[model samples]
Target: MAALSPLKLRVEGMDCGACALKIENAMKRLPGVSDINVSYGQESVALTFDEDRTSALTIKEKIRALGFTPISERKDLVAPRSAPVLSAREPWWRGKKGRLVIFAAAMFGAAFAAAQIEPQWSQWAYSAAAVISIVPFARRAFAGAISGTPFSIETLMSIAAFGAVLIGAAEEAAVVILLFAVGELLETIAAGRARAGIEALIDLVPRVAFRERDGVVERISVDDLALGDIVIVRPGDRVPSDGKILEGFSELDEAPVTGESVPIAKQAGDKVFAGSINTNGELRVEISHVAADNTIARIIHLVEEAQGSKAPMARLIDRFSAWYTPAAMAAAALVIVVPPLVFDADWMTWVYRGLATLLISCPCALVISTPAAIASGLAAGARKGLLIRGGAALEMLGKVRTVAFDKTGTLTLGRPQVTDIVPIVGNEGDVLARAAAVERNTSHPLGIAIVEAATARALDIPASFGGAIAVPGKAVTTRLKDGFASVGSPRYAAEQTAPDESVSRKIVALEEEGKTVVVLLSGKRVEGLLALRDEPREDAAVGIARLNAAGISTVMLTGDNRRTADATAGKLGLVARAELLPEAKLLEIADMKKLGPIAMIGDGINDAPALAAASVGVAMGGGADVALETADAALLRNRVTGVADLIELSQATLGNIWQNIGLALGLKAVFLGTTLFGVTTLWMAILADTGATVLVTANALRLLRLGLSVRHSTERNQ
Candidate 1:
């Protein structure tokens, strides 16, 4: 069997979620296709299929046969393309909104002229106007009917308008088609605005880059640039690729990529990402990644994937709509036959009411409600440096009743700093110098802290320590000039050589203040103690407070001692679980799940099992690659406050979705009731359907504004 590869196609002419479902169902009938996901808001379809068994061209032809345009390469899924323009250029009268306006105007003019002519000629004029206005509707309805969706909104409108014309209500039929066309135009415009954020992000990367090679600068397409090539970026220009600054100094505006509101200073040796603007710099950067592998490209790809994944509510709505349209058709048939056959009612009036009921029952607005709000929420979160993996994650985040956090790189900076040093058997500088010599080769944060402290004091490090051996997460042991020297946690040091009473007292006092105390021992005697602390992030308190205020519980899980964990938790007013191994943390997460949905926030490596077990896994950006890849969401700025922002945005988005659904259903119910009472006409029914669609669309668009305001408030609070 050939390996299955993923493909994404930019689809055109999808007006609602039902269209997405139709395309998905049509594509699933093809050979070798799997995991098909189509998004009406993003207007794209993504799927996996065996390349040897089928081809992208075959898939595009199928979509075309289904009455939609597929306008991108299947290979483009390797690096998903930017969202396509809404439509192709056409004559002014053929443009989407413009054509609708022209058709509507023609219908009105024909109606006015018919009112002044003879009755026979008037009927002909009105009939001609209705036919012209209904052509587009009829075409769509015919396509949908053939594609196995015979009860689409277009089909309902076509039936209502044709029914009106048969009853000699040609003027009313013309007006119904005209009003429905206007509603479609408004919906298209609103959807375009909802998609603006993702489009803006895609546009941030410049197409051209200035490459510096052999002491010459040449402009080239960003796609042509290779890794290890140096790119010259000047002031007021967007960085073309992710790279390290080889020379020069300046500040960069990273708001586009990381959501950092302030400009970040960059000099030689500092890393820069693609899509960030060089504010005032003359820098030559060595490209670390090509155009397709850059940070911005990854962000765009993740966001698009997120938009394609449907929420639970969206999936339920999809299932409901499958049955909804067919059931509605049955009810309409009953309305027309039952009343007249059973009660001697007028056939014409009863049939007209049934046609109007069909128009009212179209599920366009309700079908679009959830995905529109979800796409907007995903886009908004991405702009603020929160990459929610899918609509399912977004909805889960809102319901998370408890959030468990890893300590080292999550709530704290993960960079430990030496705060206090005590020499029990030697001078402070001598003890630190000896400890640094043994620790300089270790990569642990505590070891690095000791080495940094010694270097800052200008203490000369010993040139050699004999045959060093490291114990993971515990201590480093080496042979000194006279005997063995061990530098590590107090427990590990005590196991090597018992600490004296004074040294034990000092270590206890430091650990009480939430500091990590490392003991230095030489020849079975305590040399000194170094108290290091990984300071809590500036936003940790605020983020915790915000979660607490929202009635979500917060817990700190760590490998540190109970005293240290308590001290840190007390500062943030959170529950603390200490001295946990990696597996222990996973078990604790399982226990926490009994309370409610759990969200585990970590840097992604050691917390992988726990993250996988939780309701949602949130990874900090710039952490381990495995962690970011495994997480359901990632905070690019590595800020704890992003957790709070994620919850707030999710709640707001879900709220917007419910509002749209209610509005769609409420309007349908009102109009359905009116039609049953004989108070509704063909034009009135179409107007009500169109009006409900517009109202729901406008409500979903409000999330775009809500997302912006939430981001601004987060920045302000920071």
Candidate 2:
């Protein structure tokens, strides 16, 4: 709710820079924008805009339209897509350009040995090593500095290294170069972790699907699968493409899209999406769309765009980092130039103090803070089967208070089944037989439930029943020798005469119990009730309770009537329930935000818009591409309990991040005070700086072992 400033832009080339500049400028230029800053040197731009005036994508396109491709690299920075790929390795020197680290290390070691052995040989050996290291691995630094981009992290480090060498401090020069190499390596690794989940999302969709041709299923790629093309999908296969089932029945494991664990039953005419796995039964489907427009491809596009979409807070970091590095440089200059000139401090001593300031002022904490928390939080969520796309999403998840949920795939397991059957006049067996016969020709959730229920009961379906009418969003009607029969909800069977009031009351009672009631009407009388319901997830209630305990209010939002939604909410002990359509749900979320942040959970086509509009949109892996792409977080395990774990993990990871920052800053402050007071020597400063790096690095490694002992114990108890 805080007002922010638009970032100001001062960049060039930028056909790339100009593009990035325009984005930053637009952000600043917008109404309610407080300030803006644009820098091509760091390959990012920052903006402070009113959350009300412009959307996240509007800013992204402004950058993209400038013809500078925008990369999804917001630790909260908006950078060109061509900006260096963020590091994907661990939080060590491992992922930095390996050659650079090796070269810098070799030079540092040679210079250090020379300094220890002979003072006269020290200058030459150290300067030579500095030249060698700079020529090989620091060209970018020197070139970037000379190219009018004077404030790059690389340029700063290179300048400091040359300054040390110029003073005949071979040991100091060598160490500075080495330290810079390590910092670059660490930065690269952090960047890599930010990009890992998004890259995996891109890889999920294949380039092709086997297109069927004239009775022969040939392996033609997705591009060739035109509308109306027949595609064959066998058990254990991904749906060839997004299409409607023309023949065959199967159970599909659509975990990748819906994030549900159970397989959904599919029959002829059922719509199936690409990337869904057919767990059982073979399916012959007709492609409804080309590969480019398939559900899987759409998911890829959404994720890519979402990755490019910066979180509201990411821009703040970019702007802060831009000013942060230069501010530190200015502070270091004060340490050197001010003390020696005004305070009459010795040149070597004050200069050493300046070097000490430089050593710790790499903005290492700033660089590592966001990504370290993100990687750790993401890893923890993934361990519990949550696939968060990147840091922005991960951070947003922790802020959500109200949680809007999709009905079918998110809460009800997406596969409804008949749980009870009652007959008022005839035998129950006869009522079920007639119902199943009518429903056998349809593939709606209710129809499938009836058929499956009848099959479970071993009821024999009548073969001669004919004239079945499959009505969308209504009861299926068919003719029997006895009379006209209908099976559907009370509301859906409106064409039939009203049912007995007593029977209707009972049906209402059944509905209140969270059972989907199917009224069996014979002419004008209600003959029976077929109660169906989506099976509750095994751990849903437990998960909801856990979330409540963690201070996150749980909510169930559905398109179903208030009775059904309220019943489910009561059963699960959810804090809130909103029986709403897609757009209504979005409005509900908007209202919820008046109290606090909201996280929306969903995995259906109808859920996409709400997911996009929420503070943190969470996609169930078993959901559609629209939902997944629009969501800020993904529950890979498709379990409600995992969401609780994700929140807990994010909170813990953020705690760790603050601790690391405090440690880094505290040590630097103490070291700076000691160096200025003459209580610390140059060697001490060097040790302190390197030691702080090592400590932070060690602390970051804790993320690698995701099985934190405290978390493990908590899970065991749970």
Candidate 3:
């Protein structure tokens, strides 16, 4: 036995969710296949199977035999590929809209001619139109039946059309096929529009790069560029790969990657990403990452994985549909057999009625309603810089009534600066220099701030320190010349040796102003007090206010002292909980869950545990990789307002889904009632089913418009 690997294939000719279900069932029966997921919204199928037992070519051949085209081959299921290809040999009449129009026109022309001709000629005209218009549907239905799925929508439509023809309603049969064709065309267009955002993102990266070597530039594919290779990006061209600018300068528009909506000035030493356009000036960049490893590629891969994971509702619908079709077919059989056998009704009329019931009960619209709306919502959120992990996150975000934030990097800028320093015994420079030496290699923002303050004063920092150790969220200790020294929070220093009255007063004053106070100690004796402050983001208040207006409570959680937390919280008009360690923050999140569903927003490694514990976790895009990977959603622009926007988007998306479901089921109920009675004909039932599909699709598209409006408003405010 061999390990199972995943594969994805872009499928063509899928009009409704029923088609997706049919493909899924057919593929699931194959040996060694597992974890099958098919998304009608994305027109792609994903599955994991043992390569030794099956291969990609075999899977594609199976799909072809099932009456659909598998357009792209997947060597391994990883990143999403480009759109499906249409062979040049494919006839123009095979195009969706063109086929729909041609068949519809033929059906109408034949029906009109039949009504004006002699009775003997009328039969030939109607019969010819029926044969021509129904050929495509008949072929698909035949394929599905032979492939062991006798209850597919195509099969139901074919049965209905053939029944109409037998009952002397050949023109009605032609009209039903024409209308169904038009409906499928509309669905294809809607799905394409929903996928436009992802396609646009994929198109942003250029296929080729201008590599500079030996004082000359040569054009080569992006895949050929290796690390440390120099690439030249002229003005108005997209940066070919992710790298740092080695020479020249430019204003790069990073809106495509970061969703920042601004052009940032970049010079030497500044990092640039692939897919960003150079607005002005030429730039020579040293490639840091190859094409497949770039930021754009990672984003695309994450998005595709997110889209493939099904929501709870979507999975439930799949289960329901699995049985709905077979049961409906059984009911159709009962209508055909019982009414004629039990009531002595005319067999032809009852058979015609049964066929209409079969067509109306295909569950095409019901099966598609949820996924179409969810795909549109996810795409809309991605366009606005919010990367919602999957449908489950989107659905959960809508129910969040309380949002908790990690103060240091989420509510405030992660960068801290030294505000004041008070030396208790040693000279200011001597105290600062010793602290910087001990803190030089630390990743804590406060430690970095101390080192930066000493450097700004031109004090010499030691090249190395011996016996350095960090106590999480407390202090960093190292061996000094005469004795051990430490730089850390006041509580940690107090635990070693209580600070003097004067030093304690200084700490109180600094903390009162929302500054974080740390003590520099030498051998259990206080040397100086260092005050650092990480300012709140400019959009923090606006973001909190927006969440408040939407009736969600906000809380700031931090490891800083109580006074500093209160000061910051008062300024932002939110509640505060301070002096919390990583484990403490996790407990706080657990406690908050009693109030309602809680969402934690943070951008540091310490926030990872709590982020994973919360109902939903949102990470700032620029945060640590651990936090981002642990979070359920990410804000690419690193804006706090994106949190509020995500909430609104989720609410709107869930609402849109319900509306689609209602429209699909409500119309289905009406047509089913009319179908059972003598009031509905085969053509009318087909028209109703088609009309419902179009309405549901159109409703889902409204999310795209809503997304645009939200984006415009965000930009205007910015």
Candidate 4:
């Protein structure tokens, strides 16, 4: 550390690229400066030099000589507390748009100089000018490497650039630094693309709200809205905050949150959130919470939290970079000083040899290797309407070999509908009319199904039916002309008294047929039978087959009977079936993970915990609250193959990442190996190193095009 040389300067009015370049060139012309990188971005200049030969004051004066003012030191741009906030950097030029003219003039000058000389000097000057112009921009790399505990890509690059200058291969040094600056600029653009999804979430919240006060309505900032305020939400207007309806009813289009194709009906006492739009009717909402406490705000907060959380593979990259940079630096130093001193090698040959070593060790490969693949894979999944919260979720999804599905809403249509009806002791029309009359006043799924069936038959239902009462988990009873009538579960119907043996057997047969049979009974006599069942989703069988083809097994979990569950699973090629409650589902996932990692797809409110407990939790977008809130990846289109596509994308992304790493390391190793053996020139090494980086980046980008071939391959399957 004591032997390390430093050259720091109060870099002057580098208000433009030309000013920065002019200072860099003047400093480089000095006799003993081994390396020079100046950053007007941070307003600092760095140079490694002979301690006795140069001073900070001399560098400062030379910067002023370039016709700019020199400052004492870099000042803090904002308060210390504000430093932790992730500020968006200036879009194109780091907020230096005013310097466009100077930068353009410098570029033209460098080009003109390149055209006027012989090939060798022209190349040398062109590279030097580029390097000099970018010095101020590149100095952050050098400074960060020095201050940080763990070495990064910037450290390797800094070492490489200095190694070239130390051995007096100024042309190679200039080219290496120039190439690095260009790479940094490119990498910035790629990162911005990766972060677009996160930035989009931040833009969704409303800036203002209209609140009602006294007898007049007032416009107020969204943040100022407090709990209990009455907010007037008009048709097509976003709900100002989380609140409950007080005076009106409408249909809210909650597509962004729930992904339901149809608008949801909202009436008095129904809840709505800050970003939901009232599509049809006006609603007076009594705000229940502040704007910051609303659903939209929580969503934004979760996204930011997830983005900051590290993916599993991120640590591996840090470990690799830590060792990779210092090792390259040590090797570069040996290549520069050892050959000429020990073997009496020609100075010029050794200098070129060292520069080749430095060029081959550039850290571009290591920097772009993992993140490029992750970014591309995430973008691909997003395009397919799958919302994977982070890279960690994607990694887990890739390894899932077993997927457990909740049968009620995931495998079948969640709501029950009438499929069949039979009458053994009464008129069929009379039985249906009696069942509808009993069910019309109830709100249960079975009741809804019966009422809907009665409507389909055009049965006349009176608006007001007297003596109607619902029995919890059983049947609903109503007064009939002769006696009370009850339509409910077979057990409840039979409990009043035993039915005829023939009628009981008929009910058993219907249960075996996968229908929930409810008998309409008057006192002890059986009147008729009503069959209800959840129909399977239209695409369930096709989706299951695709999963099987992709080598994944499917399991069905449900609260329904073994007979009904098995009947549904059989049609979809599912072998593992569990007729269990929500807690049992969680235990099943835990047990399955012991065999291998398992993924769960569920839609019920009870299924949320089990979904979260799985290796990868996938929520059908139209699912219940717990499922939507707990799942890691959500299929926004509610398509099962989307879950499969996410898995494929994760696998492809992981493959691309490993491939890029191998490509980068293999190419760097070959070039470095040849340079040490004295077989490679600095120019060839530079070309190979930078060229391999570009190739790896391009290969990782293929993940962005990832898709399921199932749509096209259906022709062959047919």
Residue 577, candidate 2: Cα error in Å is 3.7
Report every candidate's CA lDDT: 0.82, 0.63, 0.81, 0.65
User: Per-residue lDDT of 82-130 in model 1, one digit per residue for the tens?
Assistant: 3333344344455455576686777768676876876667777787888
- Ranked candidates (TM-score, high to low): 3, 1, 2, 4
Candidate ranking under lDDT, highest first, comes to 1, 3, 4, 2
For residues 294-403, what per-residue lDDT tens digits would candidate 2 score against the true structure? 76555444444343344334455456766777887889889889977997879977776786676556555544444444444554454334556656776667776766
Clashes in model 1: which pairs?
A: none
Per-candidate clashes, comma-separated: 0, 33, 0, 3
Task: State the displacement of the C-alpha of residue 314, model 3, in Å, after optimal TM-score superposition.
Answer: 1.0
Residue-level lDDT for 306 in candidate 1: 85
Model 3 per-residue lDDT tens digits across residues 1-718: 6898888777876656778877887787778889888866667788898888888778888887666787775644554432232233244367654575687677768677776876676655776787777777777777677655777787788778777888888878777878887778777777677767777777788989999999999999998999999999999999988899999988999888777676899999988978999999999999997887676765665576677677777788878877888898889889889988999998888788788888888787888888877777888887766788889999889999999999887888889998887888778888889899889888777888889899899998755447689887788999866778888889998899977787888899999999999888887999998888999998899889889999999999999999999999999989999988888999999999998899999883668788889999998834423323658988877888889889999899889888988998898789878877878888888878888888888898888778745554664677
Candidate 3 steric clashes = 0
The worst-scoring run of ten residues by lDDT in candidate 4 lies at 77-86
Instruction: State every prediction's TM-score relative to the real structure.
Output: 0.90, 0.65, 0.92, 0.65
Off by over 4 Å in 4: 1-91, 95-146, 204-300, 334-348, 379-385, 418-504, 517-531, 581-587, 621-628, 666-718
Q: List the residue pairs that clash in candidate 3.
A: none
